[model samples]
Target: MESDYSSAKEQYAALGVDTDRAIQLLKKIPVSMHCWQGDDVGGFEHAGASLDGGGIQVTGNYPGKARSMEELRSDIEKTLSLTPGSYRLNVHANYADFSSTGFADRDALEPEHFKSWVQWSKENKVPLDFNSTLFSHPKASGLTLSSKDKGIRDFWIEHVKRCRKIGEYMGKEQGSACIHNIWIADGMKDIPVDRQGYREILASSLDDILSVKISKDYLKDSVESKVFGIGTESYVVGSHEFYMGYAVKNQMLLTIDMGHFHPTENVADKLSSVLMFVPEILLHLSRGVRWDSDHVTLFNDDMKAMAEEMVRTGKLDKIHIGTDYFDGSINRIGAWVIGQRATQKSLLRALLEPSEKLMSYENDGNYFARLALLEAEKTLPFGAVWNRYCEECSVPSDLQVIDEIMNYEKSVTALRG
Candidate 1:
């Protein structure tokens, strides 16, 4: 229903975003967002189990019990109200097991769970986006850091196939309702492995995962269904990010998380001029100081500078703004609202400022202030300019990040067929 690049320039304009530069800087802004607590609430009870390893000391206080599916949806509805763009619900398994009492399990691929999720989405106009388990309840979920190995691969493939079957099943009855979004938490942490091995694992896992939804004939099964492949960049440099380029050729796009980069890891510098490396989704927008920290959006000038740069570079087209916010103790709904609004406002400021300095081939003293003033103005009206910017800016693609995986599978299928 929405065009990929709707009113984006106007969004930038209303917020005093660098319209000229933003227009030239980025291409489209198909919005795909992330909400930590969705249908399943208690799934993350054991958040740091994998990090702590074996002994499984569940330290955090259980704020209360996790929210129910209905409560989670209400959170989503409030999120949608403020977000007002293309969105998909990040589906944690709705069951309660160690694997994540609230997230997915082998049962996620089960007929019942699949049907329930689809029915839920269809009734509420929400789509289920898949997030693989990297960390789960300490003792409950069987997730391990090394899950990128065969077991994890097999688990993902099975789940993917079941998801496809469910979609097909639903199409038979109610047309298409569910589109899958997948982001895997597989990669070596401290283990010893070669760079090549890392690249190989990433490439292979992606190939295996996407192979699920292959239609007898390639090309996505329908307009409503597509796979979005979210590939997180490395926490360290010279690691795996460079290798992700291979995904593009495989027909997979990227989703770079803001916190993944250090201050030195200037996202604008890295992605701005580069034409080949484009991402479908962008996460961790408000996480940490530019130099370090994860899942934090405390707000800083340097971060604002980064936002201005991204908009000026006009890379917003490839961006789907999100926050990787998840704290077990805090009110999940409130956390989501705060994080989402903070990140969205930051981007809106960047989108609205004039891009004169960015577009200027030569550097001048006015560059910082030109962008800084724009940022200030938005914050001045109690961020009303930021609000206006968000309201005005056009959303990017609504294609679930999973669509890329499905598309790739169709390619794989066609090649085989």
Candidate 2:
């Protein structure tokens, strides 16, 4: 591996790509891993609270779904052991700990409910990101924050407010700004009549939620948008345009989910445009088979493109990266490791790119040279660097992770059933 990386290092050096520097930077870039994957979005809201829709679904009855918060953390920790580089845990409000006091509904959530989570974070040395749960609740069957009914809107608004406070507490404990992301399943399954009214209500709800200003030093707010969802096919209240306008106007970080748009449209293309408006943005990486299907993220063209754009723009600091896929069809720990490594690999490849040369070709108007160089660089010894990185990180390489996963399944998850 060392000899192979030596050769690759020489090759990348010719293209002005420093392999050492790339690995160092990649080590610092944290990909926030979602907690939902451990239990297929089944929060500890109740005994058997599994994935039930607001607009999404988690298929397959894969055994060993983390039945408790302890098991979920165990699974996540195992996943992190296999995944390389820095990481943060993305947690939802529904995963609150009610050890002392039985349970608190979303509207009544307090920071104390997440105290255990913060303690877990400190023990694991993993910072956290937060999301307000807007699905699988009784009130979320129809509109939530954008509902015509004032009670429904107020409930969700209060829930989000409480979530923000929880996020702030997590950040304060961890000493890093915890990103509080808001995504609501608010829209009609069929054609809607009052789009304008719903949007107005949503905007007002957002204003109310943001009215109580929290410490920006501790918590940063982000709003996620969807083009169409399962029950929100015809129209989505918080469309990309809506959040884009709102995020920029309100100076909040806008979240762009890879699977939230039409499949044909590349989310990577929007980074350059959106960054021009918002100061910073959050990326929810996922694979969308249909509409927001939320498949396990891979190092595919879409992900690579986004990572490349992120690297090319030299905006790594301005981007908050996180994986958001929940596939219950397979081993949950394997799912997390694969997706997290895929994201890491994508960013590493982009970091190893001959971006400067490509830019120079573009500037010189040598289109053929640009395209040819781009195509030729693909065959470079990237695998060697990746393997070397894995060795350095003390984790299994791609060829080795599979065996590790199978071993884990036999020893761990198989016993859950």
Kindly list the per-residue Cα lDDT of model 2 for residues 1-417, writing each as its tens digit: 789999999999999999999998899999999999999898998999955657768888888889888889888988999989999999999999998888889999999999999999999999999999999988888889999899988999999999999999999999999999999988887988899999999999999999998888899999999998887789999999999999999989999999989889989999998999898999999999975459999989999999999987778899999989999899989989989999999999999998889999999999999999999998999999999888889999897889988898888888888
Best by lDDT: 2
C-alpha root-mean-square deviation, candidate 2: 0.9
TM accuracy, model 2: 0.99
Candidate 1: residue 349 Cα off by (Å): 1.2
Q: What's the lDDT for all of these models?
A: 0.43, 0.91
Scored against the true structure, residue 350 in model 1 reaches a CA lDDT of 62
Please write out the lDDT profile of model 1 over residues 1-417, one tens digit for every residue.
122233544444564444445333222342334555332234433442233321112223424323444444555665565443355555543232333234445426444544555566678665544443333333213322224456654555565455555545544434423323343333323434464655465556555556665442221211010011112222211232443454445444444555544545565454454335443434335454432334435446645765766665655555444445455454344455555555555555566554554445226656676566555555333244433344454421223313532453344322332
Candidates' RMSD to native: 12.5, 0.9
